[model samples]
Target: MTLRSTGRWFWASDAEGDRGGPSGRRGGALAMMVVFAAVMGCAGAFAAYRALTGDVDAYLASHRQITAQVLSLGDRTSAAARRAGTSAEVAWVDGSGIGHTGMTRLRGDQVEKARVRIWVDADARPAAPPMGGSGVVLGSLITGLVAGAAGWSVALLARSGRRAWTARRAMAGWDREWRAHADADS
Candidate 1:
């Protein structure tokens, strides 16, 4: 058997069998594009959801005031500050002609204050529970996956193109070699 047939190199003649064949390459490209599109779509949707359901001014006001208070205390680094409870007195009017005094703890610092703000409701219950580290972890994972996939897809396309080009060049060299041999015999 000829080297081409024995080694299954005949497939080289059929462009469809090439790694960068139109259908296969298009499928790979389309899959990569879909993944990119999905990531972008999710990011946009998340932004819109936050805009619609979240109160940006309220969040900013809460953070600014609480952060200032924490910074002013200068007890940010002390572990004791975390355990110690500093109180603020608040006054409110009741049903009768009586006023009331309520004490709220300073908590730790800005980081703690932000955590409380997200987790606790007006009633002081854990209403909007914080996602905590999970959100960060998930975001990192998604970002890494998308970036890796994009890089890999681009590399695959480049490699496939190079392979197809190399195979065509080799076939041309083989044709030239056969022609030279036939001329020598004549």
Candidate 2:
């Protein structure tokens, strides 16, 4: 079989003459701009969505409870009865009026202890705010706009490149054929 039949001659001829042909530099630049714009639009949309749907108050309340628990755990120490012995256990009622237990073990002067309790204010509101829906709407808008811009840019670049390539190829082919005819005539 001939090499051409096997697709081995695909790069044998430089269809685009010297100087890298049309360069396609503008097309590449346009494509990059479109991609950058799309990414920015997506990011803006995501931020808007979070702003609209995220519940700031509920988040703060949960964080406050967690902080109080951490503080209580740090301040409350083992009772005197437990401190005297090699192993000690203590029980205390937390702010929530729930009884909780903690145990400490002293091994060669090193003390280790663990405590468990639940902390959640009875009057606290819901953990999350109601969804606003606006954020998602805004995000969708931004995404659509950006995507459209990017697609438009890419399409324009491709169209221009195709036209340029067609013109260049036509000229080159005509020149080659004319040269062959002239040589034959001679």
The CA lDDT of each predicted structure is 0.47, 0.47
Q: Point to the candidate with the largest TM-score.
A: 2
Can you give the lDDT of residue 37 in candidate 2?
A: 66
Q: Give candidate 1 regions above 4 Å deviation.
A: 1-132
Over the stretch 110-148, how does candidate 2's per-residue lDDT look in tens digits?
A: 223333232234343212223345655866677657665
Candidate 2 regions with alpha-carbon error over 4 angstroms: 1-131
In TM-score terms, candidate 2 sits at: 0.34
Kindly give the number of clashing pairs for every candidate.
Answer: 0, 0
All candidates: TM-score = 0.32, 0.34
**Which pairs, if any, clash in model 1?**
none
